[model samples]
Target: MASPWRPIRVWSPLLGLGFVVALIAFALQLSSRRHLAQRLWTFEELALYNGTDERLPILLGILGSVFDVTKGKTHYGPGGGYHHFAGRDASRAFVSGNFTGDGLTDSLNGLSTMEVKSVVDWRKFYMERYIFTGHLVGRYYDSQGKPTKYLKGVESKAKRGAQLLEKQKIEEDKIPSCNSKWSQQEGGKVWCDSGYPRLVKRPGDIALTGKISQRCACFKEEELGRPGLEVYKNCDYLSQSCSV
Candidate 1:
């Protein structure tokens, strides 16, 4: 990566004049469109489609944060003059507009940054939700194997805080085991991660089934796609599955 300013000194005065002209034009355009009401579609239009009065507020709240606004209406930025309509925001700080190809919309999001498939980085998608929001993209599952429809990853809002997954970096460690007859009879068993027992990704020695732990905490009903700790069924499902 390199700056393109290597030969810009000769054009410095010209560039300065152009910049001034551009800034003034931008300012005037903004001032004129600040209060123009437009027909921007809210998140409700995207989410419920028809069913309203339920999650409409929540969805709109997110939409307003991701778009732009001028005066008091949704401003979709310059190209289209402005957005369709104002979305929603607590302090009216953000508004929904439009995005074509990439990047975030406004700026309100909460997702554990991770690579989803063999390709595609989820960082931009994660940011786009909270900043410049859009329709639900990801799906979160509880350890019980249930879909968390209300959210994809998790939001920082206190009421929705439980769904949030803490990004715990795993460290290697040896696990202890029991040598009981039943253990031996059942082909024995291996304890899961000795250090990160609650965050099991695969079948292992120890299964922390029904075990209450800070590390294994999942606020969302589902655990996204992390295997072993599904929330459905009775206790010890994980433990039994990992029986050695």
Candidate 2:
């Protein structure tokens, strides 16, 4: 019979290596679970994780939602290009491109419907790319971490913008777009292959923003008198093409 001690010595190195590997895996799992837990953080607590301290993870907030952006240290670190966004909820700054103290605010006041929707989309961006770690207990969230009236209003405005965008797309499919050309010799012209060209306030734009921007759209002969559409300045009522 062989000595039992020989087998133990032969397998000890492999057993130790396996143990170490399992230990590392366990640690990683614990870290991932910690990051996934939803913790309500005050503004001051959030500021501490802004990449200024190596011991803490880099975090950012948008619309009260906080994310672990430590993986993007190249961009969110103290001297990084996007460092200004690492500490607070600066939803407005994403759209305004103002990284200053005043511009880095969460206020959606006076933002157009579409602009609000764009800001909401940025939140979606962070949600997908980074780990969602918590919520900020301020403007958007109350002491209990639930959304406040102000946040609800902003969400409602963004939802309206989404609905309008869908409606505009459907209308475009129905009306299509006019083909056009312009030059020094002919000034400008618009026409359609199977319909008439008319200028109209872009659907959902003026209605929501009080803006007067217009676009050339093609419509059937019977639909020519649809509200908000007008013939080109010098074009005849039934002309297939018109000089602009």
Candidate 3:
């Protein structure tokens, strides 16, 4: 006669393999659910998660992107100082420093280079500190939820501005230092300074000589002697030419 435990021992290896396969399938299901939960949210759906109803997470939008700010409820909740920004694409507000609804649009038209920089900084702040949820459908996106021409234009403008700023920094660094002769009689006088000539141009070919003359006049006093004359002495020539 054979022992009854012989059959159990023979099937144990097959059972163990089945268990391993089940565990792998379970893990894949969980991954799929997590990915689905993080799908893109429309503006209307985002409004429901503003932390006001106490049933959903706190969410905010900036630069056509949505973020899960639930972890920062103290600052993003209903009574929080930034609660007004919840559920809206407030990129313009971030740059303009206006927390009101009027500033809560994604439109960056007519904003200055400095303002665009502020928006970019704010976007970076959100990206670093919060969970990225999805993209907001707004001026940056079309009705079909694709990136719009306006969005491309904004990106190009920002790129150009960055390039211009870099160029300005390089030019500023190239400015020659001035040699100064100090005497009780002359007080302080800048000599042996090489001037850098920058051409000024505007639309319609208007002559700007009068404006240039006015700016040059302001540099005259600094040419003589002032307490903060060191900076002017070193970059006076560059200053007169460039807008720096």
Candidate 4:
């Protein structure tokens, strides 16, 4: 009873509507994929989940993994671990250097030049976070800048750091008592005393997720008649690290 054209018109509109729905769904999927690719934790799919679970190590490890592939090497060198921690605007306290923007370069004091008030055990939580969050180091070039491959984890870097620690121990053996004077250039030949600032925890500084805090509050005081600490009270988290 229907005309041939009626069948064509009905089916064509239905088909067109179906195609439009399908197209919209496809576009949504593509958008989702793009967002997921940009994310640090691909396996966790944070898009549909709570985003707070993500932190520095999660992001840094993702970056390191991709960088390892791009450069074809582990950045931490053989038996070295690469780590990154998020400091909340630490540069405001001590930097007055020549640089621009939000980066480590913004910190005025060179890594080497500060005084050590005490040992806050930065190495302790440092290793612990690296252990919990995990790591991937890429050191593609040797001293001569030649190509290499593969990567290592915290255990490896700690072993290498241990060698450096040992060298420090040997040097310490040569200098007896706290009265002895010593200095080292940490970055850019910036010289300073290298001990002091024991980390102590303050109350109400705890987080259920991610790292707590640790601080090296001051450099050794006796050096140059002024004490120095490897790290000082730079953040609330650092205060929390000592709370225990």
Model 4, span 102-169: residue lDDT tens: 44221222222111100112324333444322222223223332323311232243344445445645
Model 2, 40-118: lDDT tens per residue?
Answer: 9988988887888765678899999999998999999989999999978889998888899789998878888888888
TM-score of each: 0.20, 0.72, 0.57, 0.22
Off by over 4 Å in 2: 1-36, 179-191, 220-244
Off by over 4 Å in 4: 1-150, 153-158, 180-244
RMSD of each: 18.1, 5.7, 11.4, 18.5
Best-performing candidate as measured by TM-score: 2
Ranking by TM-score: 2, 3, 4, 1
> In candidate 1, where is summed lDDT lowest over 10 consecutive residues?
112-121
Return the lDDT, model 2, position 50: 82
Q: Against the correct fold, how does model 3 do in TM-score?
A: 0.57
Q: How accurate is candidate 1 locally (lDDT)?
A: 0.31
- Residue 92 Cα positional deviation in candidate 3, in Å, after optimal superposition: 0.6
What is the alpha-carbon lDDT of model 3 when measured against the actual structure? 0.62
Task: Give the per-residue lDDT of model 1 (tens digit) for 45-93.
Answer: 4333221222222123232223222222222322333222223322112
